[model samples]
Target: MALHLPQAASLPFGSLTKMLPLNKTSSSVSAISKSFNATTSLKIQCKAPSVIVSDQSQQVSRRSGDFKPDVWHYDYIKSLDNNYKEHAYEEESRMLRAEVRVFLSDTVNPLQQLELIDTLQRLGLAYHFKSEINKMLENIYSVDKFKNKQNLHATALEFRLSRQHGYDIPTDVFDSFINDEGDFQTSLSQDIKGMLSLYEASFLLMEDETILEKATDFTSKSLRDFMSRNPGHELTSQVKHAMEVPLHWRLPRWEARWFISEYERMPNMNSNLLQLAKLDYNMLQAMYQEEVKSNIRWWERTGLEEKINFYRCRVVDNYLWGLGMKEEPHVEKLRRVIGNLCAIITLTDDMYDVHGTLDELELFTEAILSGKISVRHLGLRPDGTMVEKRQA
Candidate 1:
């Protein structure tokens, strides 16, 4: 669902200014003036040695963010309703999850098991089988056959998965693949899958690991050369995507969205797993839509948008930022808290960065430091009433 928001404006500083004795000559005011003068190098020449002239009457030009209006609209967000939220869909998802779990249990080959774990993670279904995955990885790590493996893809995958799950697999795991001159073997370039895996695994390198560093440079150049040589190869797309951004650094939800489509094109893609991923994604998307709507409503009730107009009005963007941090369905409360905090922070940041006058910002900072204003004070209405806090 697409929801568009208007460009945000500055917050109301009147209440903050009123919280302090603006007319009285206090130490705080002198300190603020000194700090501002030091930063701006303003020369104030006054006949009275202790008096400072105020510039409140002067017209001050404010900077603007020049940010465009939000793309997602409130009406569009409210209109979003997917059938995946139905009970029948949830029941079907449970059945598919069970089938996939059984498949995971039945898989015996080490390489296949690693591939399956990688697939589940990429598809964003790993959380549903956390214990099972941990058990599998534990068993794989305990076997300790990575040094004996001749297949570069298997070794690289094993190294990557092990390090990712907190197993301290060492850099020496790649010693067999490196030549005496301390470089990756040139013959390994012919194995595209292995090269891609090495490229991915190289990202897990720690400080001072020169071998993985060399592997990164080697696999990067090799993957580019291979892609140029075989432009129409099935693995070319995956290679190019990997070269752009390694899987280790990608966001879970976004990667799942892209990989699900790519997985559909794979020859050996599991039907049950594919269906489960699709259903799970849609269900989560629907829930996120509701969460965004709730946050937008909260924003409206605060009356901050109508009262102040110089900050970014990005309720949807803020919620999505929270989603990127905690994508699990069960963490709805944490997600909402994060979203609200992000919204408030963005508004306050814009005020300091783009809109607030020097004196006004100082007063706000002082109020915060003196404990005269709390986060709850941010929900104050134009009529001097408090907006009731919403329960998560």
Candidate 2:
């Protein structure tokens, strides 16, 4: 390789060879040392090339996250109160669920069955009826009842629900919706119910499904226009909600919370199902409330805030996890155990990754292995008794 350099530039070796070839000290290397120091001190300071900045680039970065820290002066969570205990609604909940199942069993039309399944899923009560729902869906798909309906709303509904439940339906079923102009039929825009159903259905598309890609673009525009024209209509809010976040992507608990309110407003809403849902939610929420208290207390007494820096308190993290493990009466006990485990593990991980020294780690390991670490303190104590403490 050929060396390239600016012709006027000087290299450090330019002087180094000159000095090295002609150096001798008169006073026992002192003169040579001084000369060497002086030569090296002649620094060739490198200047970084300046970058040009536009006026817009330096003002501020856009906000990346909306998370805010807890701001209360006292222990707001622990100091606050809840009055709920376990409910005696197990028997009642069972009865209501049985009645709803009876209602489902009596319904036979495929389209009607799909509507019930769809509504139950959206309402988040579908978890209770999984076996029955699957049996109905299986029969409907095996008989090819999906194609028996020509109505766009019913076809889209069947297509979406079937695909969602893991049945394979042809993407070509949607070709009927495209007009001679090679776009989604503009006349079909008036079918807002079908449009919304199609919009939800479009999300189930596979990679090569260009028809669904067009359907997504078409339905989005159509729905946005519908929202503007009929802002006061009953379906407007639903359209807006579905456009923002699809049903499959929503957290089941939050979806249930949102849907329960919507379900209550329906004139034909089943009283037993509605009552069961509300009671179930309230009782489950109370369990979460209890778990949150346990976690916050564990976090505080561990002195995690003083010991750790910048790590989140993680009370919310623990509670959300515990809420996901819905095991009823034993769930409270499980939550406390698991919440403590998570808090310890999280802080311990941060310590090992970021703040711990080799010496501190050695001590931590020894303490744990030797049983000197108590449930309350898990602290590294060398000269103290290795007491096998029971859990706090």
Candidate 3:
């Protein structure tokens, strides 16, 4: 149960001391801020908007390629849909477990294993499946019922529900690792890698028409339910608009195609929709910036504040140098975004640990600070609107 994991140069896990430290400003970050301002201030050429004003009659005749088709090509779409329904999850799940087994057993070829890892990652199981994989790894080495295929599958399900992080695990499986405490780090590293893989997997799912459709349907239904529950509220419109606009405007044709395909396959509109909505909002700003870069004055007027906030929200002092990645424009921007994200995560995680190990709290915080989190009436508190309480 205990293996001395090669001490990874202690990763900056939840900071106890630094979370609320003094002056809280480092000189290095200040310099970076000054440089960032100077660079952004440089005069750059802007592009003109693609649309041109024309006569009404001519405009009527001129078809913009913006119209989304009500249905996809029936024949081809049907066959693809049938295939997804028949296969996608079962294949991905089996393949994922197999890949982890191979890694733990040290039986599979490294290159082949990595490819399998990449596939599971692309499929979006990387993180969810990983915690279970680590559990399985321990089981393989320890005394838990690995021979029982049902147990293995149960482990897989627990992982999906966020139980692998010690939520609703079987006592035997949980205690098995407790016996061998040394391998904990290796288990955790595997878990992290797995989560990373799932994050990538989500992107892969994002591109699949079938997956995207299921997600959208799910989001739409959730919105409908939310609205039904709340009779009338001003914020409802804003939330609804946020959900719909991204689905209609921000989601591209390619993603739409995948959404349709996914809908055909899974046909369930569960959490996928929320994930898609979040992804849409997060990526849209970047896409919008790229789209409007040509019109200098327009860019200055519309985009400057957004760009500044985007960077400001993400900037963190430690984020710039940690992880050994080189500093550059995009890197700097990404670091800031990640920093902002982590700050929110760190703050909320404290609450989660205290309140209830609420997985959605992390996801919700992720959504909120990333501009995706929305809340509605459970009722009002004395101070303000009744918001979902975090641990704090």
* Candidate that would win on TM-score: 1
Give the per-residue lDDT digits (tens) of candidate 1, residues 24-116.
232122211111112133222111112323435676766666655554455545555544456765777788889998999999888899999
How well is each residue in 1-392 modelled by candidate 2, as lDDT tens digits?
11111111222221111111101321111221111222333322111113322325544222212223432222433443432232344565577688899999998998889888887876667878989999998998888765634567878888888898888898777667777776788887888988998898888888899888888899999999999999988888778888877765555555666677677677778766666665565445555655666566556655656653534345545445544454345546666666566656755665565445577778988987897764547331232211243599
lDDT (Cα, 0-100) at 88 in candidate 2: 40
Ranking by lDDT: 1, 2, 3
* RMSD, one per candidate, in order: 16.3, 26.0, 26.6
Q: Please give the range of 10 consecutive residues that has the lowest summed lDDT in model 2.
A: 14-23
Give the TM-score of each candidate. 0.81, 0.65, 0.18
lDDT of 3 by residue, 159-213 (tens): 3222322333332332222224322112322232222222222222323334324
Q: How many backbone clashes does candidate 1 have?
A: 12
lDDT of each: 0.73, 0.62, 0.30
Give the best candidate by lDDT. Answer: 1
Off by over 4 Å in 2: 1-68, 71-87, 180-182, 321-392
Q: In model 1, which regions exceed 4 Å deviation?
A: 1-58, 379-392
